[model samples]
Target chain A: MDFSSKLLENAVYEMSQLPGIGKRTALRLVLHLLKQPKEQTERLSNALLNLRSEIKFCENCHNISDVAVCEICANPKRDRSLVCVVEDIRDVMAIENTSQYKGLYHVLGGKISPMEGIGPQDLTIGSLVDKARKGEVKEFIFALSSTMEGDTTNFYIYKQLKGLDINTSTIARGIAVGDELEYADEVTLGRSILNRIPFEGSLKAN
Target chain B: MDFSSKLLENAVYEMSQLPGIGKRTALRLVLHLLKQPKEQTERLSNALLNLRSEIKFCENCHNISDVAVCEICANPKRDRSLVCVVEDIRDVMAIENTSQYKGLYHVLGGKISPMEGIGPQDLTIGSLVDKARKGEVKEFIFALSSTMEGDTTNFYIYKQLKGLDINTSTIARGIAVGDELEYADEVTLGRSILNRIPFEGSLKAN
Candidate 1:
């Protein structure tokens, strides 16, 4: 594709570098920007630059924050002794939206994915171990996905926390809330059966 | 959706304003940027801002350019007397990719769309008429799309150019090359049949 203007070409090139964007879509976006008011474009650029450059992370949980510690960590109402460990900030947001989990969170940043050259060291595993060793937490919930890398990270953290005066647990694995029982995968169905909760326990949420 | 950081929320909001992007996809893009090096984000921001702030257009054809006149309009090898009137720079690039035309071009910016509150005055039709009145062009090729608005814009320009010494013709309306006849839309097939070219003319391109 030919670009008559170098400035347009440069913008399109940078936009297409993003995941899932192609040259055609990038061109469409750039042209849309050109058609918009100059202030709109400036706002977009400013927002991105400000977010990237001036962004701060929670010193304790590593979640993005505007201050040294995130709101969750700073909240006195949250159960600081109970921490939910997850893969990223998206998971934090997802769990937070449910409003069921009243505990603090520890964002792992990502799981241990050897295929992606990501190791436990690349994540917040070491910092989590430090917290675990300090014995400030009563329970650490492994809330990562049930993928292999998630299991590996969970096991590695569990091993690190073993005999360190901390209790370790994982979120239950079962068919989704609205999923049909017949369509549930055999492995999940079997696990759900083996880990079935008391009949009265299932009635608590409602 | 809850955001752990206000900066992240602002960035996602701005990114989601692009056409075809939604909140979920915008969050994904913004999170990906957050994980990358600061330089990558800076490059993207700088490219978009610089393009929007410093972009230029061809003075004659109104095609996007870094100079007063676009390369096509400035090239002496191009046929100045044969002008192709197109809707926008994308059409110019499409025609250029074919490499079959060596003529200059006039970009109309957009078609006549009453539903969208756009009309001839909102476009560059007056300048195009002026160019035709100057008597520098012997033939004007109408290369607009076959949509209703495209036809309206075409007829509007044709009316303005009536009684002028220059000849006016439109690009042919027909089924695309390699299109299956059975699957082709009814309107396109009907136009293709009505505007069927002479057997010799059809045989010319191949």
Candidate 2:
């Protein structure tokens, strides 16, 4: 689209570089900022710049943090021996919100997606393997998604810890808590039946 | 949701302030930015800052521009006596894309909407009336959207130019091009039938 102002065009172009935003949506968003108070734009720009320049990742788990080590990894109450492996900090936040998992996390940064040119080396698997080889972790839970990329990453990590005396397991996949049985996908339903747990054990956990 | 880093949280909060963006989408977008090169983030922030701080509006028509007067308004080929009053720069861009009208534009900034606490004083209506009184414009085409606020704004401007010798007209309300007549809404179809133009005139315009 033809823009009257070069500044407007530049702003819209940069905004459209974002993951999901298109040119038209970027124009709408930039125009909205133009209509708002100037301070709002200043605040947004400062926040984004600060985030990029000043943000830190925890040395232990590679999760986003404000300090050298993240709060989750630094907390004494969290189980250091039981590490949950996941995709990114968003997944860390999701599990943290449940208030159920008390173990530390190892953020993989992303799954192994050859289609996207993201291989195992691009992730934090090497650090995780080092931790396991040093006998720091006792049990490693593969909490990655059930997608093909997720499975590939999990298998790659599992293979890395082949000789280590570490207990490896994956998160259970089944029908969602409030979902209908008939609505469950075929693979999930079949796996749920094959990996059926004890009735009393499920009750006790709940 | 609990964010692992304060910087991440702040960035997401500022991002979510944009229209239609929620907390989850904001997190997704922020994470995407984090995964990208830091220079990309710097470029986006700098572009937004530059646009907000240095952008100019056309003095003649109130359209966003890099100079005192926009290209359309400064061009000698455009009819200065014929002006199309619109809501904002987006409308100006849309009308310019058509290349069907050779008239100048008068951007109102926004429609007067009581629901949003927007008044005529908040718009550039006074300047338009002043132009009409100065005999600079011979006709005005209200090209605002077919909404209550658009109609109210149109009537208010029409009343302000009541005694002036300028002719006032509104854009036609009818079924969109390539849209099936059976699917057209009652009001638009009814208005189209009532204000039907001669077939020869429509054919000639095309």
Candidate 3:
């Protein structure tokens, strides 16, 4: 039967609108939340309500922060000259978890997809160019995904700062370490071959 | 590094507390919420906050509702005398989705799990027994799951209402449709054999 409460129905409808969620799953989540203590649910509610209001985009790197500058942008130890540009804050967290990179980051907000009507102007690319123009950063790392739109966006951003002395680079696209050669896809194998480094004991091939 | 904002950190912590969610996934979900429009995020926050204050448990059937008595309990067409007792509101929704069971429902909050420190006293069992004692319900259907705890709960409830004239029945334990005999687990096969119905063929006897 149809749900009787309009408020509960509304709650489920809103939850269903979230990514990777359906009406049935949303109903389950909403009911689970309803079963919790008022204090607990209220805390979650207040946190979500104040999320955008209390947080603002970092003026320097465009990462999310409670202040004008994000922690990564404000940190002194991080390599300010090497900046990694990504599509969203989640990508920043993904790279941070690796602990391999010690540079700052720039969130582009989204990629360039003409079909979806999302162009370079829709992203934070203009601000990114302005950041690079400040003469502080020496390298611009294109850490966007390997999708076509991601590549187009990267190309567009690279061209914007081509006239400047800043060196541009993209993340590697190849088979991971310890992976079998037979299992590698054509794209990855081709990239690895194109960007090949010297193999052990290989006399510099003429 | 630690989160850029305390509010963001708290939001991540709360989201991580949900089942099957971790710190990384929580960050992704929170970032996704932050990327959405301000109005959509506000709607989600308001829905979560209003859930607790707006909804209340139905005193009669113990189902979640905005009123004192839930819609199912308030309905006159439903078979109130044939109550389908279940462990939680999720079970109520599952049964309601079938549309075959026209009877009303009684949610027990949870099954009898003594090891988890959950006992009959901790549940709404007393209310159920009291309802049974009133001699209004003609049959009590135990629509619990087929887990160890479910069986223990079913047996306990069966013993409690042994002397009562009301007919009591548990859901059947048998072979499911489209199940392969070779693939069926021994326990399921054994239970199915034990609970088997009479053969229809004239030459059925071996």
Candidate 4:
């Protein structure tokens, strides 16, 4: 009933801070914890405390990693020239689960959303441009979200690479309007990646 | 894409340990963290770490509390003679939200389910019986679930208090089959409490 205790209240408050969870759900979680064995609670506490201490981000692709380079970027068998540009590491995980894309990736950090006060300077666009300037990468694939901000980011990046010889492309229009790339089933996302389209002017003459 | 850092990997692993969350969800949560300002992540971490240190269970009622006795158990205005018996602290919260039931509560820890390897001895039943034996209480309200385990627990407790003069009862059968009292809407659960029935021979000619 009335949880005036600091421990239970703090636990509920912390859990409520998570996305999609409310105060009621937080209370439910705390009560469930109270009913569980002491070992379970200890494990949860240990897991939370150890999270930041042990994990790191891949230096090359920016995906989550225990090592410096990550498994995807370190795999020499994968295609390195075709780079998939994504908004974050989550997008990289989504692409990797399907085993559909063998190429490397470039994390943009976020899309160019002016309304939200995010700009090109806030992203990793410079690194991508430098990667492109190196001339090793043959293609730069835009695997960003299908939102208005995502479109703006695509256009901005496209303009930045005006003179580059590398091919620029975006994942297909098959993904319905307003649909999130992360929420899309594996089959749909894989199909969309496989059916990518080249940018308007980037399609060079044979 | 490839994820390579230990910090990122640890964050993903911690997120995955939560109920219903998998590797993909964990990755998304970790990426979401990466996108947030460092201050927000710090606040979350602080809140989580303080969870165990800030609160504890009430010594008398077993409700979550910052003090030795929870507000409900400590309140002089509440009906001390009438104690509601429930499976967990969540049920206490559910009842408190209604602003009804001036009586106090006793958390049984859990029900008796042989299949799940839980028995009467596994719960906080001895203390409940001790409270009833004190002769200060007039009634004992069983608010356990309607499952076989709940019934088994209620029957076991009833057998233990066979000689006590206190009136023993249970929350009404108006609650639907297979419904958890914690999940029930306030109104339905409220009515069930109002329509509770006395245990047969519990208050016989004291």
Q: Which candidate is the best by lDDT?
A: 2
- Stretches of candidate 4 exceeding 4 Å from the true structure: A37-56, A75-78, A172-206, B1-10, B42-46, B53-55, B173-206
Q: Candidate 2: what lDDT? A: 0.93
What DockQ number belongs to candidate 2?
A: 0.92
Q: Say which docking band candidate 4 falls in.
A: acceptable
- On DockQ, the candidate that comes out on top is 2
- Model 3 agreement with the true structure over B1-206: per-residue lDDT tens digits: 46767889888887676555678877877888887787888898788778778778789878878889988999899987898889877788787877778888888888899788889886777788888999999999999998988888888888888888789888777667778899988998999889777677414522
Clashing pairs in model 2, backbone N/Cα/C closer than 3 A: none
Give candidate 3 misplaced runs (Cα > 4 Å). A98-102, A198-206, B177-206
Give candidate 3's error at residue B38 in angstroms.
1.3
Cα error, candidate 3, residue B53 (Å): 2.3
Q: Fnat of the models, one by one?
A: 0.92, 0.95, 0.60, 0.44
Across A4-29, the per-residue lDDT of candidate 3 in tens digits comes to: 57778888898778776778777877
Ranking, lDDT, top scorer first: 2, 1, 3, 4
TM-score, candidate number 4: 0.77
Model 1 RMSD to the real structure?
Answer: 1.4
Q: Provide TM-scores for the models.
A: 0.97, 0.98, 0.87, 0.77
RMSD in angstroms, all models? 1.4, 1.0, 4.6, 7.6
Q: Ten-residue segment with the worst summed lDDT in candidate 1 chain A?
A: A128-137
Q: lDDT (0-100) at residue B51 of candidate 4? A: 57
Lowest summed-lDDT stretch of 10 residues in model 2 chain B? B197-206
Q: Is candidate 2 or candidate 4 better by DockQ?
A: 2
**Could you give candidate 1's fraction of true interface contacts?**
0.92
The value of fnat for model 3 is 0.60
